[model samples]
Target chain A: MQGAITIEGVDKRYISRGRETVALDSVSLNIQPGELVSFVGPSGCGKSTLMNMIAGIVPMTNGRIIHNGKKVSGINRDVGYMTQADSVLPWRTVEKNVALPLEYRGVRTQERKQRVDEMLKLVELEGFNKSFPRELSGGMRKRVALAQMLAYSPNTLLLDEPFGALDAQLKMVMQQQLLNIWREQKKTIVLVTHDLSEAIAVSNRVVVLSGRPGRIKHIENIDIPHPRDVFKVRFLPEFERAYDSLWEQLSSEITKGESL
Target chain B: MQVDESAAVGTGLNTGGSSKAVLAYEAGLEQRKMMVRVSQVLFAIVFLSFWQWASGRIIDPFFVSSPLAVGGRLYEWTLNGQLWSHLSVTMLATAFGFFIGAGIGFALGLLFGKFAFLAEVMDPFITALYSIPKLALAPLFIIWFGIGIESKIAVSASIVFFVVFLNTFAGVRDVSQIYIHSTQIMGASNWAVLRTVVIPSATAWVITGLKVSVPYALVGTVIGEFMSSNRGIGYIIAQATGLFDTNSVFAGIVILMVVGAIINGLLKKTEGWLLRWKE
Candidate 1:
């Protein structure tokens, strides 16, 4: 596909107080256009670092990333990013916050409202357009954040554990909603999450990374068909095999990661 | 303490248990409000009557003016229109100084907040100047702007500038880094980030700064008038002091207190309106 992202031999290092910390080492991956891929790993595995690089918000220590056909540079505005923390502007109402990306794109006022209204409906937040971020529940706020990310119709999405903070039931609901949206929009999504079941439920492929100075431990294909029910996916035989194999690799890394 | 409805019903204290509890709680609240009102009125009456008695007895009336004398002086000023003439001058000076100082301070504060390197370079100088009492600059202002309201405006602006500057600076600096990042990811330019995120976040702090500096602005105006002015409330107080007219001084002080209280109440109302979203 034309809008594919190729991450080649990317490495990231952090230097603070005369100390060196290697966050990612010789990491490489290829994400096809319209594919939903999850980077599943233990904490400190540099999943977030990889997401940042893809978004072009952070510089890598070495190697490069190609977005669409161009080399990724400062702030790849072609992609939408959703972080673990709800980053909705508290001062803005729901509709206004969601319309931010559209506003940044210089979309006109009337068009912005129409687009925001549609997005709010998609997220089931039609009536909450005037409510401030502080007034919304956690799930509702996450919906707003998701709506914000999708507002500008970006070609790709870089989600760094966007639903990690949610409870299990909410997470499942969000996953189902995300799947529904993905089916409709068909944008390339690169998700960073430590939740193994979450990776299997939503993503077509799960890339498992090792501990600190993270390396690709394994990449598993989840053959579960689209329009899959997230609530019932775990009961499937295909899902069981995918889970067992991925968990076997991930648990070892988790133990090793914890020791560090 | 509240008794839960189901628990109270189980104990058979009252069949309409929850409603009764709610009624009792509401009654208690009303009783408290009445008590507060009674105490306030009683305290005011007792204090004013004691001051009316003590001014000429325990304390010399020449030093501490009696309440009755102060009241009479206020009545005399009101009847002759002297109070309005002096009060208008002070109010005009204070309003001019407050707006001008607060405006300039807000503008520069936003500029400095966005440009950290510039703020850092000017930090020591700004702090040094801010530390010096604004009243000390009154004579210099008088020399530059003369004894008119211009001098008072300059002095009040100087005082208000630092208060607002410090508040706006801290508010802008303290905006969450995550929020900024999120805005940028949505393809926002630096200017867009400031407009949508920084300004709104810092508004509360800026308003707080404005509210806090109101009294200081008044102080600067009064001090300027006290130094040298032909007409103002401060002039009235200065004149009373010169003549040892304690009652006039007391009246001037009471007038100032009333003005300050009204201004403070208005400011609080404005703050509540602006930050209503926070609730």
Candidate 2:
């Protein structure tokens, strides 16, 4: 069976101003196909760095990432990444922004048009095809961004704290929306989030990472059912147990980062 | 600002799909447009009336010619077709110079912006040329290219080229990293990313530069005319000044201002049409 993602002996290092900074050290993890995984820890745990490697955006200093039994070299069309900022093209309307990937891949006129239309509907932005990004609210822009990423129908999604900037209401709404979209598509998702609660709310498994030169501190398999409720997540005894356990592990990582 | 209201209404009507509502909306828009025009007319009358009165009684007509005298001079020139010929020459020179200069400037900006080494090599030469009074070299342009439209076009184009080049260079260079990352994640090739991501991002800057350069082209033409041209509004102004015809000078300046306004208005409209994506 082809695992969705297999990271073997991965080490990520960045050399800046002649000082070598090891972002990740021999971090190894395996993501099963269709697994919704969250990389969670204190800030500077290199969650984003590891996600970047999985998506082939950042080259690992050592080791390799294999997606579908193929060693990834550069950007693979099957992977879709949504970073912290919703960098929707200012020039394109909502529909056009969603259709960007298809356009670049030379998806034919009729099919691309239909996919754009369908994606807009999927993201509940059916009527916002012509609205520019500036005209959109932050939450609405984020939705457009989600629509754009989902438009390409990528088999895997790497999201870097996409809901980090939103108001609480919008964030919860987006978390649910992402879950619903994930339910519909069942793509392998690697989400990097600092909010431990958000990680627990969405992911099938939460990987707690250590401080700088991040390594997996703890891996807890979430037994939560699909169509999970963010509001009810905190009340679940299992949720509290997992969160408390992860916090205990993460506390020292954050403290170590500050001390350094 | 009112233009924005109608646009919102237009958007509202588009999704509503009610024919009667759209028809009523269109009629309402027309009414607003008529009211706008009427207000403009009233404002123009109030201002011009004050001007005419001031020139006739409050101020010396010698210092500031009465609107009537200028109108009469404009009428005489129009009847004799002197205004038409002179205006055409200036218009021709301005149009040709504007296109050539804008074209060259835009191309160079894109090239230099894309290639940093090229930009570095050309920076000193461009800066040196930019600082020199473009008009001061008009006589030399005339000597090199002669008294034809070629000289005028060259002079105007040289003036316009630098401004547009600088703006376009900035526009292209400032392509957002976020957008680039987004495109890269989408697996966009270098050329595809440049065309879709880079070019659109920089269009607002390029368009702004072009709009400013439009009037610069006219200045170039008029400057060239001051030095050597036998036609154009600049040529007419030179003749009028030789004979101390201040009225004609005012008339030429007035006409030039009007043309400049019309060109700017057109450019703004084109920007509205094309760069509607710009915030």
- Can you give the DockQ of every candidate in the order shown? 0.35, 0.40
lDDT of 2 by residue, B1-279 (tens): 223332443442244556887799999999999999999999989987888899858888776776677788899999999999999989999999999999999888988988999998988998898899888878989999998788999988988888899999999899887788679889799898888988788889999999999999999998888888788899888998898777788788889999999999999999898798765
| TM-score, one value per model | 0.92, 0.87
Candidate 2, TM-score of its B chain: 0.83
Query: Best-fitting candidate, measured by TM-score?
Result: 1
Tens digit per residue, CA lDDT, model 2, A43-142: 8778887877776777889999899888987765568888887789888887788889998888998999899888877766666778887776666777
lDDT of 2: 0.85
lDDT of 2 at B117: 95
Q: Give the distance in Å from residue B60's predicted Cα in candidate 2 to where it truly belongs.
A: 7.2
Model 2 residue pairs with clashes: none
| Residue A238 of model 2, lDDT score | 82
Q: Which stretches of model 2 miss by more than 4 angstroms?
A: A1-3, A225-233, B1-65
lDDT of 1 by residue, A1-260 (tens): 55599989998999989999999999999999999999988898899888888877789999999998889888888888998887998888888999999999899999999999999888877667787877677777888999998889888988898888877887888899999989999989999988888999999999999999899989999999988899999999999999999999999998997776
